[model samples]
Each structure stands twice: as C-alpha cells, then as structure tokens.
Target: MTDQTIIWLVLGAISGSFINGLTGTGTALFALGFYLVALPPLQAVAIVALMSVLAGLQGLWVVRAAIRSNLPRLARFLLPALIGVPLGVGLLASIDAGTLRLAIATLLIVHGVYFGFRTTLPRFRARTPIIDGVIGFIGGLFGGAASVSGAIPSLWLSLRPWPKAKVRAVLQPFNVVVLAMTVGLLFFQGAYNERAIHALLITIPIGFVSAQAGIFVFRRIGDTTFRRLLIGLSLLMGIGIALQELF
Candidate 1:
C-alpha cells in the first residue's frame, strides 16, 4: 500500500477498535469513509465489510460477557437483524448507493446528535435482546453500507446502566458476528480480493493496538467529555457526507 492509504487505513483501524471496544457498532463508518475515498465504490463496499468481519471477529474477545448476560435479548435482535441484513445488502447491490451512503451518513450524524444532546436517555438496564437484534440488523445493513452501526447501539448502551466493561465486551463480539455475515455477502458479489485482504491484515492490528489505548482512555474520560466529542464529530461527519454527495 502507498503511505497515504496505509495511514488512512491505520487511522480507520484504530477508530474501529476503539469504537467497537467502547461502544458496539464496530468501525464500519470510519472504514467505509476511508475506503470510499480510497477505492472504487463497489470495492470500497467489499473492503468495508471485510474489515468489519475481521475487526468484529477480533472484538468478540472483548464483549463475550455482555453476550452471556443477555443471550435471549440478543437472539431476538439477531434474528430480525440477520433477515434485514440481506435485504439491506440487496439494496446495496441494486441501488445507486451513493445516495444510500449519503442517507446513512445523514442518519449517523443525527444518531450521534441525539446521543450527544440527550442528557437522560433511558438506561438499557435490562433491554430485550430482540431490540438489539433489530437494531443490529438495520445497523449491519446500514453499517455495511455507511459504517454507522456503532452509533445507534453505542448510543443506546452508553446510556444504559450496564457496566462500561460489560457493554464494551458484549459489543465487540456482537459486531464481529454481524460483520462476518455482511462481508460474506459482499464477497459473493466479487468484492473480496487480495487488495481487501491485504488491507485488512495490515490495518486490523493497528486497530487492535490503538483500541487498547482507546479502552484505557475511555475509562479515564467522563461521560460529559465523551458526549461533547461525539456531538462534534457527528456534525463534522454529517457535513462531510453532505459535501461529498453534493459537490
């Protein structure tokens, strides 16, 4: 890879690791954003899925406990999500997806804004796994396309009284499974190849190392600070997506 691509991929990897570790949606947005600019649209889609599968797989180690605590709820969410993912993937294959991506990005920004602005969102203290499955399916679908999966669920989990450690742990593995499914579909469409593979190999490690730092840092930072950062990024990412399509 060229130095520039490597740098971008590395940044994307770290973003994935941290977000997946701390929140849940994995790094689809950052990876998609990076790949969108770096590769052909079709290839970018595959590449994003590829990284998600890998990173998600890697993240399982972090969030297995979260899954153990809420298996039934997760099953509900996953069943619907699994159904929705293929539908979403089909949408990706058939549509002129720049618009889809634009839409997804728009939602991500909105999701992030809501996450930031809400001072007292309900705690997921004990949520239905089906809720998560549905969210995950939509998130996987949109996440596969727009890389914003982590935003919604993360926002949800962060608000819940779930221990920060458990939240992080459960999210890591959850993303990995969904990402695996998403990428498999993408690959069937001829999106998988040496380039995407090489990219994943090189960058996932970057994400892993950076995620360790992100985990530590996340533990240290207060919720107030995290919300502020999330809001700012949401605004910026939204505007950037708007400009990418409009301009």
Candidate 2:
C-alpha cells in the first residue's frame, strides 16, 4: 500500500476500533467513512468486516458472563439474520460497485443524522419474535453489503426496556457472528487476497490500542457529546463522497 493509503486506513481502523470498544458497535459506520475515502467501496467493506470480527471477539470476551442469559433473545435475532445474509451477499455480488457505494453513502448520511439527533428513542411495547427476526434479517442484509449489521440491532435495542448492560451483551455476540459470516462471504467473493491480509496486519496492533483507549474514554466522557461529534463527521464525509461520485 502507498503511505497515504496506509495512513488513511490506520486512521479509520483506530477510530472504528475505539467506537466499537465504547458502544460495542458502530465500528462500520465510522470506519467506512474513512475507508471509502482511501479505498474502493468493496475493499473498504471487506476491511471493515475483517476488523469487526476481531473487535467483536474482544467485545464478547468483555461480556462473556452476560451472553448465557441472553441466549433466547440472541437466538431470535440470529436465526433470521443467518437466513438473510446469503441473500444479501448475492445482491452485493451482483450489484455494480458504484451503485453499492451510493447505497452505502446514503445509509451513512441518514443513519448519522438519526443517531446524532436522537437523544432518546421510545421503547416498543409490542416487540415480538417475528419483529425481532425481521429486524435481524434487515440488519443481515446491511451487514452483507457493508459490514454494518449492528446498525439496525443497535437502534432497536437502544429503544428496548432492557438494561444497558444487557443491550451491550446482546450486541457484541450478535455482531460477532454476523461479521464473521460477512468476512467468509466476502472472502469467497475474492475480496480477501494479499491486499486484504496486508491491510489487516498493518492495522491490527494499532486498532487494539485504540479500542482500549476508547473503552477508557467511554467511562469518562459524556456519551452524547462523543456520539454527536463522531456521527457528525461521518455525515459530512458521506456527503463528500456521494458528491464526488456524482460529479
């Protein structure tokens, strides 16, 4: 990789790692913004998937105790997600790269605005297994396309009545399994070759340090402030990329 490319990927990797460490999710949202600037859309997607598997493993370790208790809840989310992922991957493989990037950039802009502005979201009183499974399927589709499976679940869980710890516990394992599958799918699609391996090797150690630092800051900072800043940056970058591609 060129020095400039390496620098951009490292920045994105560290930032995404930190976000994942803090929220147990949101890594793809932040990382894709930077990766899209430095790499091709599908390459960025592949890199985020690979790193997310590592990050998700770390997250699950931190919440290992809570995973057992959330099994039923997680199963409800996981099954439909698995069913949907291959379908989404099929779509991704068939779509034009420019169209895929446009789709990804649009999601980033919309989701960033939504996450940044919503101080509190209402809990759904009518949540059922069917609804949960559907959300998982949608999340899986997003994951297959962009390594962003956590977005739907994170938003849905945030509004649930579950405690914050339970939410994090569920999110960690949920994202882990989905992201692992995404990596495998992308690999079969030939996204994981020498370049992908090289990128991962260069970024892993730095990502580890950044993730730890994010966990520390998560405990110290005001969540609202940190979220607004990060998501705001994502929103701006998404816009820039979309405009560049269009023009």
Alpha carbon lDDT of each predicted model: 0.61, 0.72
Q: In model 2, which regions exceed 4 Å deviation? A: 37-40, 93-121, 125-127, 219-247
Cα lDDT of model 2 by residue, 27-109, tens digit: 77668777877777777788887777787777677667778888898888888888777777678767664575577668667
Candidate 1 clash total?
17
lDDT of 1 by residue, 205-227 (tens): 77667666655676676655554
Task: For model 2, state the Cα shift of residue 83 in Å.
Answer: 0.4
lDDT of 2 at 45: 81
Model 1 TM-score is 0.73
Give TM-scores for every candidate, taking all chains together and pairing residue i with residue i: 0.73, 0.78
Deviating ranges (above 4 Å) for candidate 1? 93-108, 114-134, 140-148, 218-244
lDDT of 2 at 80: 84
